[model samples]
Target chain A: MCLAVPGKIISIDATDPLMRTGKVNFGGIVKEINLAYVPEAEVGNYVIVHVGFAISIVDEDEANRVFEYLREMDELAELEDETSS
Target chain B: MARQITIEPVTRAEGHGKVTIFLDDDGYVRDAQFHVTQIRGFEKFCEGRPFYEMPSLMARICGICPVSHLVASAKACDQLMAVQIPETAEYLRRVMNLAQLIQSHALSFFHLASPDFLLGLDSDPATRNIFGLMQSHPNIARDGIMLRKFGQQIIELLGGKRIHPGWIVPGGVSEPLSVDKRDTILAMLPEAMAAIQRTLDWFKRTFDQYPEEIRTFANFPSLFMGLTNDKGELVHYEGRLRFVDATGKIVADQIEAEDYQKYIGEAVEPYSFLKFPYYKPMGYPEGIYRVGPLARLNLINFVGTPLADAEWAEFRELGRGAVLSSFHYHCARLIEILNGIERIEHILNKSDILDKNVRAYADPNRLEGVGISEAPRGTLIHHYRINEDGIITYANLIIATGHNNLAMNRGVLQVAKHFVKGDQLQEGMLNRVEAVIRAYDPCLSCSTHAVGQMPLHVELVNRDGRVVDELTR
Candidate 1:
């Protein structure tokens, strides 16, 4: 099982519909994720990924809410360091 | 009748591949070649990316065993940062790796190679798929799905999804396992073990049916390479590389991941996009060796678990030296599935697995980092060079399929020479050629990571290169 984890899409490369990919930031780590599955997803939107493909999109508030929980847990140090204030 | 036969667009694999058989004037097989026929520029495309993104980015290489790439890349990033990951993180990662082994081995055994074994290699192509297996042996098919599903559930429980979960990151995992996740895996242990055991028992009982395959299927002496724990036991995620010669003698032991270049060199063939990784001392072609399940089983003396250790003993008794027949890769795979269950259970029972302090964060302290691990297929090495800005300057990946390319070519040639007759062109005979490649369970998708689909087309040509026969499954 590889498709797990939610990351915010920082940028989208829609040059090719079949090969639509985007840069997603998972906390501090950034990866090129396929956005073909979630065609409506855009930059700043959060998507759940499997393999290289984004399977589903989550609301901005929900994605932020999880980060808020992590911050509360004191497990967001990596993000606190890398993410913009 | 043609003097040469080619099988293109071979079916039942992740991506593209093809096989060519050269026949003499007598219509007998003379030479054979397995062509990957795909290209992936991962090295070139991945340059300039931040070192931290290595794990998540490289995980995109193969959907089947992305965890292998994830963990290995994370280790390389850890090396770059010179950080010591939390103990719990290592344990969680090891469990995930074993889960990956279970799911992937199940896929290879049940979905890919079983139809040939169970339905008979000569079985009709249309009825020789998972559906056919379901029609005849529903229990086996069901068990296979459950077994694969169990592996997937474990992954989902630990990371989140099945394909390329971003939970495993640089330094360590993104978070620790919960009490529920740990308990859920533990509860399913018995069922998982039983399913694998049934398949193993069935395979052993039916071993007598394919004696010809057992003998001629890539049965030769080259070398076996795999990772082993310090005490020389079966290791997947982390261990030193060990090389054992054909006769089961250790050629090189405890080779460091950082020193991989000194022992192994990558050679390129114009026919294949995948690099032929060979032992440096022996030189190209001559230094050909095999990796993956069969090689791992041959290289390790102990499995270090209860159920799998028993199976390991039996597997060893089959061959006095190395189990040269690639057919036993099936047996090795089943044993690994059992080993994986036991190993995962072992980790689950460990104390302090739920500790919150899993990641070890730091800045890049080194310019070069090499991460090595045993993927479900075989040994996978990820080497990277990062500049001062922590962006990747160079990236090289030696996938397990690439490592076995040399042996795979040899295996195809050997099987083709023995079984293929141009005038005959029997379906069973042709299937055997593809079966040989399947035995290695080569992941063209993972190895090439290139573009486009490869339809396996097997073509037969006359002395003047005129094609007369072709087979595509």
Candidate 2:
């Protein structure tokens, strides 16, 4: 199964009430994702996306925890590269 | 009430699907449906985003074949910018795409399809899985694991990480391939090749055992479609779309990727979220065509590699014109894995593969752009229309799984009629029905991950062990 990471919704398209869409930033890479399932989702809210649909809106605390883990991964990669060099 | 049989989350494939078999009053099969219960609109969400992020964004479509989406989506973005990617980048992308095909096909063959072949379809449901294959055929299991690992490792080497590698970008790859990485991938090819060759040989021998399945499981005439090289040789990463009729005559020729919507028309069904795409001229059900490995092999002149070409010849011998049996799709998939590795090996040995110039920087130059490539499953196209600011206004993705929707439905019905008996359903009967769908390897997540869970409908099995009615919870 593909892992659905929680990315922050930076923008939302409300042109259609029933089918909502949003721009989500997974760190730097921004993707416009469907927010139809998560009608409550707004700009700055974090949601976990699978395929193109936002399955669930992640809480700020849980989203932060995942982000912290990601940062640690980046740091670990840097450490490994430095050691290898 | 007629006996209704439902198999949920059709095992071994990437995503979820359910097979519903409705039995007639006399215990004959009435109708069977391959329902895509999940749908995440990849196209709906991609609107209003910059074209450059498409490759990475679309890669999320399927973890099983992310590189397929990455390459195809990148090509669309490249078209959006109206600039040709550097030659080295194209070569590098081709290598990555092949690696993806190898890895994804390995999962299909080794992880998903092999259990049915190695372990008999009649085997215990709990025991008829990869784990069962391990307990029974340890050496083959290890080889399968190692083969998939080699492909994944190569992907990691080039794209930086195995799953959802963001290295593939709009203009080109994010970085150049390191010589060390190339050498490492080359060294592993031989072992991978040997493993697949062994598996292929074993599968060919096993083919004779399942005469019933070969003859009945989606074994019928349907138009075949795929990408082909300039001279009409089998090409995966890029080429013109070609469609061959059941009699192996060219029905459609040299159709450009951008003009796909003109010829390919999508039809919606109430049962499955996956669209049934058919050739426009034929219209609706009559226009139904199959795509992916079997279709690719059926539509092509040759596989364009040594090891796979040998297998392709044998595969073509399965039928007169186009191999109608979807069981042969399993055969075509394994051959493709072999070809993928060989092609990647050939690419690594080339000189310009190491060229530092990979990306071509450009702003959006066109309002509309379409990109097409062969995913591990079949032909994939990503069409995008951008606004003046380069933000995507509209997008349409025709996935390989959806392309096989018509054939998959047909396979389900055929297998249900052939296998399912009475109200007393055996586990193997359901497995066989699911296997028919697996033959096409439908990735429901990639196809239509639309809605999460549907309302629970309780199915009541009677004293006679038959599902007579469904009660809504």
Candidate 3:
């Protein structure tokens, strides 16, 4: 079983030059998220997304760590190659 | 206690839900659970509010279908207020409902369901979504986007802002449908209709390709529920509840919207926050029934609109008496798109559609009220009890998805039992489960808005209670 939840942001737009927004991939669906709420956020960040709105920001390391843990347990079915045969 | 899996904060719809597929000792499917993850205390919240305030307050329920809630809540309030709204108001309300129908059906089909259909079930997960759809079918995606925009534009012209427009009040709308706006909306109708027609033609001609998808995808038998006028016409607003069996025979007729409690009963489960509503007469589990587009199409013989009628005939020919497959819900919605165009055309021709006599002010002297209307998904009912001081004492909201709870669960289990096999998880099998939810288009934010997000943790344990692995995303 795999899950999707909200995480906080350690930094905003850590990788992107776009300061107003950055990229966050939820289960591999990367969407450019707005940094209106947490202007202080930088690279390696997380946030709860709903209908294109970022309800809250999450931690990047925590989110990656969760994915790693899920990957170890085989609960997180890597969607990276879901389309690829 | 058993093998478990969880997808927290499921997306592509209004709110949130999780699907849990249970496996038996022999690796056979046990039961599949689709749990609605959110719960709002709206009913309890309305307990102490005034009757007239319902239309506006209930409008806040779901940003997607607030009009449905507003219409239902206002109708119920009208019943208590005992004031007859003008005929012109009724016509305007119908126009609003049709506008909502056009946009909402467009969103569900083009934005949500079409990705699954056009992308191919087994396609790459990353590319199988809306982004991929944009790349592949740019025109088709554009049609959906434009069509939905038109619908929202209609609502904005008639109500106010796109979502949760506060135009429809108890007696009538807060204002009249302007002639200039009507004319402008009418101007775009032809292009919109053409776009919809193009997509419809494509789907109809290529129907054969989706045989496997149409046949076994949520194609289980269940009862149909919807609203019908006294003349037994397709009634979206102010009508009685009608239930029909799989054989297309009326199981119950003339069931008043106010007395829905007499026939519907809600069942609770330990795993999910959303309640499973069942047919009170048949009881839980066995009383499972379907609502929404699939159910609505099953209940109606024809949509009456010319283009829609043509598509409806094809839909019936494809699925027969009732299309049980959730995949066909997308098809049904397209048909409604045609129907909405025809309905809009008829309304536009009527002079009363833009009459200034829209609002009918009524004294809020009643202690209790009920509002009921056929939401695009299914029947939506809002019941409120207010004290003499004009404060609410009790409230009950029967949303479109809530009405189809039993049927949704049944569809999920049916798909799980049929497609899910062994320990191996297949994308096709998972899509089937998601397809079932798509059929109802359940709005979790509308259903429940108060609860904080809960973490979904699923574990598959062996006989010795050893956790071989844990998956958390």
Candidate 4:
């Protein structure tokens, strides 16, 4: 019954720590989400939101590192093929 | 002319469902089909969403078993990240999942299916409900409420909310368990144990009252599938997949979640929205296997808990091989509740349960991932494929109810053939038909991923498709 959506933070109202709120973009839809749980979340960061609250901030660097490693492995495979040939 | 009797919006279960029983001209039952009328494309719409959001997003599927969706979805996400979560996080997740099982099973056995057991399946329709159960068996009613609350309170204390707790993240839970929360859950265990034990005793004493029901309510041979620990003991959170034949012989063991597609196959029927999952070796219709409480109890060697192990020993004696009757699903649920309470207490006592290292940080390390766990009803599976950007490209979920689709249809026909007579629609007969569906506690909402009410409506029509008689409650 409870629905959670992921969105990018557009603005943050951190004036009140208890009532920290942020405008988030869920695809084309936008809504204000409670950011009290994720105090370190900043504008432009993606957050996993549930019942109007942002429960976790998406790890962008850690997310990108996975693909970076994949790219490096692909490059290494290409070099290995050339050397073997 | 041949006639079709349709039960629209099957009552006392989650979501919207209907049953169509075809009768020959002389009023003999010919066939029956259980149709899940509503559909929500959770898999289709999930495309392009980041993989990390999946656990919470999928939790929207059903209120009753949101934690199941959360655990399965999170496990899939964990595969994408390719990181082993902290030991404490695993224990914490296990606790929440068991709590979810206890509450959901209580809802099925006590709240939804108890009316028939308590008031007699032939009782007055007007008062045949949870309220009716409350009025007639107040202590049983109170126990149900209190037991359900005990489980939900644990979920709330852990996840921050009872229904859709977002605390269970991809790598691990977002927050670690506090000493306070741990002690609170421990305090609730004794009462929860007593309540489940009382209910179990009552159920055993009353079990023999319905010999006819025990024989006809989907009582037949079928393959059973569930997750089990390395020792082949009962498990709910994480374990290898095992499949056993009706005779309780292991057909497949130590099957990993990633290899599910190789062993299990999904087939679709136009009659129902829910997809039928079966063992690939046996193929469709022939590969029919049951999951959930009955299967779990049948496949496990022991429950590994003092109280539940005792009950499990007695339960296994119910059948030479596997308990064939779906009627015992109610009994299996009570035993599970007892085990869940014991298991939760055991985990809470772990030294590392309060450790702060609950979650691990990682990037997507794999393109495809699969998560499998035992939900309240049965085995739940969530599969996802994400692009390099970690956006989901494909998603598929085999809900517990969907696994029993073929068997549920067979069960409806079994009950209909036994009880339905003449052109008249007897309340007791129809209730029996609905009761068979309840035996499995089919969560139609989770199966179809649709939202709706629980009240029932039935329509009897001739082969010409015109309604001749109708019943609603």
Candidate 5:
């Protein structure tokens, strides 16, 4: 599974932004997301998006938790040795 | 430390990608990563543009699958317009879609996926190409080029140009299907059907040699998604979304195309620009599903055409219920080509298909609307909320490839685990990875806009600074 990355939002504007909605930057790439679902979200908060919809609120801590889980799972042999030996 | 084998540009596929496989000292499988490097932000760029321009602009996304983007983008615009298109217009669109299926499938089987099947997977890299196939089986190469051309010609006749035709519009097509042009297309159906039959016969002769390939290596159980008629018949132009398990049992059937958001959700990964989409209720990897020709074949009981329906039966009897062999993706394409021919013949024969009242009228007043269609690859949904004046306020495109992203990653990993041995990485291993990609026949241009000018970096990086291994294709 591809985990959602944490990119600090650089800005959000109310004007005629990229898609008439606000445009948010994920560091390098700027993605245009629908505002209907998250009309209350601000420019600074991280949002988890898929197919251009912000589905959930994502913080740095939650993003880190996802990474930690993957890191633990990556050490497949270590876990196998601990269990079998 | 382990030795890393990196294959850059993951050859014989649609987009630019790389595969990295790690092997431990004793030659045991460690890990694998398939990285897609390009990011074409069509959705971001498409913002603020007139909705009508999307069909033309999005068509330029991929040279190979421009028809798919054109169709989906036009259909989305049509939804926003809220116009009842004429019956003839619908049939014209169907003709275009069927043509697209034929050509795109030909490109996949003949050009991209053929090398593995024709020349054994272990064949020498330098000689394992279309030319290599031409060295022995010259007839197949000629057949592929012609069959693919017939598909392109169908698009040209209707849309004014083959690659990225701009004829399909928000209300309806820009023009009607002309009598002369329709006759020309009708004349070619027999030849196209003959070509498909020849290719299928060739596949049948040599298919048994690759039993291991037919069983695993990108072949696994997953939910299948495709557009089917309300009666559960195979449909390309208009239908509801149907989901079936690997066993061919209905999981969630009769999903209306307009109400797309209720069941689908998208997820992102840090490693690639592509997004993973799954069934919302099932969640994440477990909810992961497969789309495109193989999935379409799996989800439907009978193809619309008589010939294709018969082949569908022969395919199921092979014990791969809803055939899972990545290799049979070629077989599925042939079946679709046959179906496309039959569908085109059926549509052209309809007098209303060429009726003069092609365009419809709509106010384009809706602030929010969703358009969904079965792209040749899979289910494509374009959801947009427009301003009062019909200017697009927001856009969300759930591309077919995006829906298949999880399956692609898993297939790559599975193939790596199955074929890549510890001591050495064989040519077959690399072919298997490419095979997974070929199964989807993805148009990365349509998924993301094409960033053709920039060079991409594909290297195996360890935790330390050293670059372990890499080969640029």
Candidate 6:
């Protein structure tokens, strides 16, 4: 079964990566997740959590770049609408 | 003395399962059984609940591929309401379903199965896992994470959350796709495309390395079943039922979802909680067939997308008939992911994707309804009988994993016979047995509607039922 959720890490509770635990915000809700699988994840970083473990850290830049592209597309659509009108 | 080998709570799969192998005195495997150990009784508990709540309720069956349950359950409720869903709603549902497939398949291939592929099946058990994969091949692992994220992000954009999103409802979706969400999903497509293509190339190159595995991992003649469009192209969200034999000949086609029970029969086994679904005409056990990626690829004529179609062309060449080996299920998953990405992009570009007319409101007109769709694993059928008050009286779910029960059992025996030896229990031999089951990528939780962890323990017992040896992980 492939159920996992992306959450932003709010705080780290442990120092050792293998024993690392953190509170992650899933949209508005937050829960403590194990960060052993994502050693590089830190406070303010987004991680993909599955069954209580952080499986991977999300690439914030890559995510933002997609939104930036979407914004540009919105601008282009507006220009096309204005020209047609 | 004759002995029995039991592998309990099979690891790396979605839910609790175990394998029991009976070995003759000399240590040769005589027979094997794949057992589903947990049961949730979702159907029984669903009674007395409002029919409209079925989608969200059914979505709780499994965390993985909840969208498939949502789609199938919603479709059943639509039939109960007797209203045709809007075109945009259907397209939106299709996009979400495909997104589910991509994410689920990625989890199967990358997180669960890749470690076995990258680190040889005989590799160190302690290191043979996703973490091991991340340490050894970070790039491949990253691609898998990204690909899965791409799917989850789309789902979150559309359904409002990554798992069990309640956006899909009876008759239609809760909301229409917004311009920003549509464009955002489109923007993510290029990266997802590259990730799948790269993984596909790597898998194709690595495929030939496992000749022996290809020959024995559920490599036998049986029927393959899945959903197909009118043109016989690949379809996942919605389509007519199709069954093809091992030789790739159409045994049954265009079967209505409502008529599924007439063609398929559910048989119970004393050994497992999962039901054995077989072709009705052929009868129980003998009507053995497989569903999921392998069966889907076998049943379809083409994948529809350019990149996936090219890979599918090569996949079909693996077998003269229906590609009997279950080992290739991994390869089939990669191609499907590619197809899902392309299909999602195509659906988003449709003019009506952002249309406001997406929901169809209607009261219950039908007391009995059947909904069928292709889940990430295989064909998922949700049937319900409701009262005049719109309360469900009965519900039956024949999950994709349940359909492959017989094949998975036979596959376990096949792998066991080939690799398992007398009293001595080698880790590799047992790993192969589990590998064969993993090839099916079964969600035992989905099949039985059960809940549990993925932990495995195996035991070897002598004829007197005495425990001779054991392995636990």
List lDDT for all candidates, in order: 0.77, 0.75, 0.66, 0.78, 0.66, 0.78
Judge the docking of candidate 2 as incorrect, acceptable, medium or high: incorrect
Candidate numbers, best DockQ first, in rank order: 6, 2, 3, 1, 4, 5
Tens-digit lDDT track of model 5 for A11-83 = 6655522112345554355645533234455777665432233423445554454335334433543555577
Worst 10 residues of 1 chain B by lDDT: B446-455
Stretches of candidate 5 exceeding 4 Å from the true structure = A1-85, B1-15, B22-27, B444-468
How should the candidates be ordered by TM-score, best one leading?
Answer: 6, 1, 4, 3, 2, 5
Model 1 DockQ (Cα-based): 0.03
- Per-residue CA lDDT of candidate 6, range B352-431, in tens? 78999989999999999999999989999999999999999999999898999999999988887887677767778777
Question: What tens-digit string does per-residue lDDT give for candidate 4 at B35-80?
Answer: 7754444466578789998886566434447789999999999999
Query: Quality of candidate 4's docking, in CAPRI categories?
Result: incorrect
Among all windows of 10 consecutive residues in model 5 chain A, the one with the lowest summed lDDT is A16-25
Q: After best superposition, candidate 6 residue B360: deviation in angstroms?
A: 0.4
Each prediction's RMSD to truth: 10.3, 12.5, 10.0, 11.2, 14.5, 11.9
Q: Which tens-of-lDDT digit does each residue in B1-473 have in candidate 1?
A: 21223322221222456677777898877777787854344466568789987786666534447788988888889889988899999999999888888887887787668878888877766566555676688788778767877887787788774345689998899988889888989999999989999999998898889899999999888998999978899999878999999899999999999999999999987876678999998999899899999999999979999989999999998898888899999999999999999999888898888898899988999999999988999998889999999999998888888888999889988887787666455566667777888788776432111111113557666566767776764
Kindly list the per-residue Cα lDDT of model 2 for residues B152-216, writing each as its tens digit. 67777887633457899989988999889989988998899899989888889988899998998
**Residue pairs clashing, model 5:** B27-B422, B40-B449
lDDT of 3 by residue, B1-473 (tens): 12233433444322455566667787666666666655334355456557777776555434456677778888888877778998888877887887788777876776557777788766654456556676788788778767776776787788874234668887887887777988998898999999999999887776678887777666777888888766665668766788888777888888876688898888888976567888889887888788777777888756767777777777887655676777777878888878888888788889768788877776767776667788888787787777777677888777777777666767777777777666655555666666667666666431111111112222333334444333321
Interface RMSD of each: 12.9, 15.3, 13.8, 13.0, 16.4, 13.2
Tell me the spans in candidate 4 whose CA falls farther than 4 Å from its real position. A1-85, B1-14, B445-473
Please report how far candidate 4 places residue B380 from its true position, in Å.
Answer: 0.5
lDDT for position B123 in model 3: 68
